[model samples]
Target: MGLFPTSPPRIIAQHLQLDLSIRNYRTPAALSTQKYADLRNEHTFPPFAALPEELDPDLSYYEMSGFREFKHSRHWCFLAEISKVEWLARLRLVVRDKQGALVPVAFYTDDKGEEFKYRARKGSTVMILYPDQHFFLGGTTGIRLEKESFCKIVTAPLNELMALSDRVGRYSTWQAGGRTCHGCDEKKVVDLQKCAGCGMFWYCDKTCQTTGWQSKGHKRDCKLIRENGLRAMFLTDRDRFEHFIDFLLPEPVTASESTAAAVEKLSALSIGTESGGSRAAEQTAVIVKTPYKIQPIASKGKGMVASTWIPRGTRILSEPPLFRVPRDNPDISAVDDIVVSKVSQLSAEQQRVFFDLTNIHGTEHSTAMGIARTNVLPLGSDSRSGGLFPIASRINHSCRHNAQNTWNDNIGRLTIHALRDIKWGEEITICYLPTVGSYRERQNRLRATFKFTCTCELCSLPCVYSRWESDMRLRKLQKLDAQIPGLLWGDRVEEKTALGLVRSMLDLFREEGIQDASIARAYNDAYQLALTCEDECRAKVFAQRAWEARCVAEGADSPTAVKMKKAVDQREHVKVPELDEDAFEKWLWMEGES
Candidate 1:
């Protein structure tokens, strides 16, 4: 798209230095620094021009539209007057379409630039107390207001306005100014004392002052302010309206704001860190843990998308939970008992810290108990404690998971790696379902249980993909049944033969989007095959990967990952003896391949 179209520009002026030429001349089209400076200093807005002949004391003009059907709402336009004196105050006339829906029809402008700049005096001032409860949806259609259209004006004295602000704990005044005007050294020409009646705007001596009061435009703006002020305080008191006003003209998110957001994320996190209030300390570490590379997927939630390609064996992300719990028992019956009993196990000081924590579920309890009951990841192992990890919970689940997660007990961290190259713009999904069945079965389970539809690649596939997924479990079961007898007998299967079977299973599972306990077994089998062949390099890699999957599905502190890690590490240093290297070649190997 081209920048600065003929239409009203969204881009604002960069430099806020007041136009020095405006200091001497008092033109209706141009704004003077004095007027703007006064409006800003006093925290008042430009006036509303139209006034009702008979004032209704009971009624206030400001009202939130489309309250119950918020989905249909648009921008919250605060309407008021633009006066003759204010050289820079711009106005946009909003109108409803044929369907009577409110929309921005025309904008008022003082300058030719895309952005409007002012000292604050000419700008209308009104505080919205409960902005969160209201949303402004202004468009090309809806309840419309025309440019400089006269609306019934109501007046509030300076003390009343200040009183309203105080009722909401606002000590410092609130005013609207151009984003660039901050810290500007420009001097004001008009005295604010002139516009006390409207509580917005200013004027110099009569030569310049009369131009504002009559020819320049303050007369029109004065009426607009009265209407807007009454509207701002209508029905709801001024205190509740500050939040709304704040939302309409929000403070820019600076470096400090970003830092604050990061701190909030850290404070709420429950994994890895021992300290509870270590937001400053954890920020750098937390930011670093996020993957250096992130691929966009067809995300349905917030932003637009584009795509990128992926390569095999890329380390996607490595994360540590904000908090973690080791569950030894899996039975749900004893879960409450385990949660309660485990709290007492911590040291006295640790106990105090643990109880002070907040649960992700928003329950009232000690931090340890809240995390344990609400955010635990179920690792399928003998020790069934669901370990609570905060960062991990943000990752939503999908039937077809592109990345694999594992918990490292030694490091007490969670690591994730891409199994195969993933394309950008593909939604990253973990399998939420315990198991996959036919299409209908998967969909029903996802919606009823997880409360979201299964829109993963596998779920969206054609008949071929669907059929392959449907038969996967049967094939896995058959393989398991056939292998049981041999493993029971401790038959040393031929190295090549066993490796081929495991590789075949792994490939098939990837195609069918099968992420389950079976993948772990196949990985284990591959590791064993590498060990038998004395391929130390390959064995170490496979063992580690398998060990991670085992930990994620089961638990890091569980016996499985620990045992696998030990075996892999020990094998790394030990030299495998070359005794009867071909002896097992006769046991499981057929008279064929390898």
Candidate 2:
């Protein structure tokens, strides 16, 4: 008992007709007959019987066990439930027949499985027409689906559909004289009310409708019938194969105007302003003048270049992420699945923009995953997530960068500011490395991670002497970064000695021409050391310098810059002798006090 009964009425038989002149067909019970003995011996036997004559006049319903022979130019159909789905090199489905025999179904359409991904879920019934037995490598046999229009998926289990078919055959038949009421079993010529859910089973009044609904098991059957529109699957002439059929077969009625109103109400309630805005809302309200444009470079690919003479501390750009990836998940397959799902939600133009970016990983990863790994930036210094920005991703890497990119929590966007004055036509760049290292070290990391050799200003020093000096300064900065934290809280070191070490770090930063956020961080460290020694005069100067540097690297509205501004304003005014630029530096370092 599948989707059709053993004996269908004449009305259904007239609609479902198949060509019967090709070959003689035998039912499962007639397999041992003398006429088909050789046919059974040559091919594997089918587990299930042939479909009823009213459903398919000449064809037989084959299961997985009977697909042992590969026939050329043969047409067939099978009913199975999807048990598993794989999205690797291709879209492969593991399906189980009624007898619990499992087999793989692979798709080879132009879009692979993308067009059918939404319908390939576990436990859904699939009706594949004209599929062929495919022999895979390593001696495994499976089924292959080549055409997209030849398959259909129903959003229900196989057993439920079979049971619904039996119910439809018994109650939905026309009588010669009149219609019979299902509740009271009386024939009537007068008009009767039909079940709105399934449009079957006439009732005389409300009492009889309720009686049929509750007492006759129509409640469960009506829901399945209405959800899947099961009557069309039984009566339609599918053997003709005029066109493709998708889910919600026979096509649900178009929604009314009231449906659109209800959807608008739900959208307002879920994403309303009273619920506190999201990053998407913040990004919509942001309006900043962009001073850079993306264009092709000589040796490198597309990159951002300054369109105007941007001064230091100018906000170049602010943008939200096109999409984000969670930082905690390590499973590559699961991450790839998530990336595919996120990319599918974008508009057609946005999807084009996302895929147009670079993919250094080549064919090792899927297209979406490869693009994400190449361009995703960390949301914050310590954030557990990363995001891909359409504008920011175009800014290429340089060892000695002219601009700095920072994630601003207050605005919920990534901001780019000029670390130094960027002249017109100058390419805007940012450091991709977590820390500055020697020339050789930076080149090795950039080549291994980004698949490009570095030719930045610092890496191309024009001579061995200049390169050696740059590496020496970077080596000393690394050692001081490691030693400063211990000395700040050490028991044996004096406060003045710690202050001198912080001063030495600043001198190195100036010598290396590092005007990025590292300078702001070093100034803040000096401020902390002076405050610990209770020197209010030096602390105020250090805090003011830190605020200026932070404003230059990150915009004035950045979190660190705001905090430093408050620290400078809250300190008490201290009177001192007037000094020139040369003497102010010595006074700020407490040169005469010790």
Candidate 3:
């Protein structure tokens, strides 16, 4: 609860400046002479060892147990040879430092922090900056590394950097640096070294650089590059996983141009700016014309409103994740910190969107991490990992939602589509609880976890006596979801019975007001059952339903959507001429009864 500064100590930042400059990455000049020099005043982190041990009451018990807390954590840099490092549960790690020191760097998820897998080794020369001291009760004590913290693992001597030219040369941005002329994107420029003032961009000559300063957009970009520590983003190869080795580390990738391009893309994404490639707003605008507008939701701070009536099967929004962390939960604390770092990278408007999100964990945890927990929607099927989409986040929680949210991996964006026709002026919503249950169960889960009592239609029912049908439908839905796997997996199953159960499940979903990704999956199960039984007519119907369900859940462009489309297409010509549509419907469900 007490404040610990996030900024690195002067000594640590200075050390980083030296390492980066010597390695020919983010040079010293670039670090010291930031365009916005006032940014330096933002660091109020005290010198190493400033915070006294007396204030933290539980300090002695932890230190006595060899899990000493580093109260003065900022800029406490150490050139340590790792004697031992263990990957503990929840991503907390314990490492023995060279100076007979043992510290715990607790909590790192597989996002930007995943880089540690390559760095933390038995005998690697690792330099960690701004890690708070931490001591556990059972002799496992070390520094706690936050998401903003970084470590530079010296795989090769600074003198030998030139030897890695072949590998580094592949990164086009590295070769150009600030030397690339902003006016023409040319590296052949003469005297196009660092910009004399900000040290962020380069130009061919005084005239070209001036044109860049005035017209080519470098004038605006130079300020952002200085503030965002974009040089750090530029120097690190996000994909190059070179493990730290004394003998033969993998190819030394000096930098990644892809990361630089991403940073540039973000920098260009100013409010009211023209829409361009891969920008989140532009891509979403393509599908839903003037899709939605953010407005105040009285009790809930803000919510997404249906600007116009959005029809079922419409892909309302498709956008890249504001930030994505690995779906793993080695430690909740470590993952949360990494999420904070990613949020820090968003543009002004993007940050505004993120900060404006509702956090149910108010006053309990870090602001950014809390909002992430409250707003993050699952990105993958297993729901192991997730992402934050501001537009989707605005659609508040309800037990019976008006809209369905899905993560479309093909497009790499979370898509929110109207499950039914969402009328204008209506507040769009998404169900937060995993699966709908009895009224009491839904209420307890939402209240305990999200810290709010849900008053959606299902929860708003007068009493158990009056809402018998709703409760019965919810109970049946829960039971069906549980029994589905066993029903599908059985060797000697009754195909007709399984089909009937699937049909009942769909009916229950409708009765319970459930419009979810699971609906598409349920239809898929029905499609499989009909196909295995050689009921082509029924299979085609189920497949078409699955296709439409997914079109409203996943995007129309997704592979599953395309496959379902084909299933319906393949059956267009294969019709039994003897039976009409109603007769065929009776035939599919009545095979066992007959």
Cα lDDT, all candidates:
0.39, 0.65, 0.56
Error of 2 at 93 (Å): 75
After aligning candidate 3 to the native by TM-score, how far in Å is the CA of 532 from where it should be?
2.7
Query: Top lDDT: which candidate number?
Result: 2
Number of clashes recorded per candidate: 80, 0, 13
Please provide, for model 2 over 1-594, each residue's C-alpha lDDT reduced to its tens digit, 9 standing for 90 to 100: 001111111111011112111121111222211111111211221212332222122323221212221111122356778899765324779987656678788776546676777778898877665444554321355666654655667677766655655555445544554566877777776677767766656788989888888998788777765554454444333333322232222321123436556335333333112112222221122111345679999898999987554556667788888888987788988988988899999999999999989999998889999999999899998888898888888899999998899988877888888877565578999999989999999999999999999999999999999999999999999999888778767765466777777888889988998889998888888888877777787778778778878876876678898899889878747544445444666777668775
lDDT of 3 by residue, 1-594 (tens): 011111111111011111222223334333322221111111322221332222242221112211332222221233344554443122334444433455555443224245565455565444454344443222343554543234554443212222222112321233433334666666652455557544445567788778877986565555543432334433332222221111111112223446555334324432222234212221121112345678998887788886544545456666778888766787878887898789888888989878888887876778988888887788866867888877777778887787777777777877776776555567888877777778778888988988888877767787777578888887887787777667777776567788778878888887776777778999899888777777786787688778867766655667788888888778888664344334555665665473
Candidate order (lDDT)? 2, 3, 1
Over the stretch 1-594, how does candidate 1's per-residue lDDT look in tens digits? Answer: 001001110111111111111122122222212122122121122222111111111113233232311110111223322222111112333322222233332222212111222312232232211111111121112111211211222243333433443322211122233111111212243233334445333343445546556764446555544434331222122212212222112211223346556345333332222233322221112111122333233443322111222222233444444434556556544555566776666668755644544354444554455556544665433334455444444455666676555555555555444444333344444455555556677788766744567666666677775666556654664575467436434546466656656666766676665654567777777677777667675576567667756643544443566678787667667443322223322322323545
Give the CA lDDT, 0 to 100, for residue 334 in model 2: 91
Cα lDDT for residue 315, model 2? 70
TM-score to native of every candidate shown: 0.34, 0.51, 0.49
Residue 294: error of model 2 in Å?
Answer: 0.6
Model 3 scores a C-alpha lDDT of 0.56
How far out, in Å, is residue 460 in model 2?
0.7
Angstrom error of the Cα, residue 347, model 1: value is 19
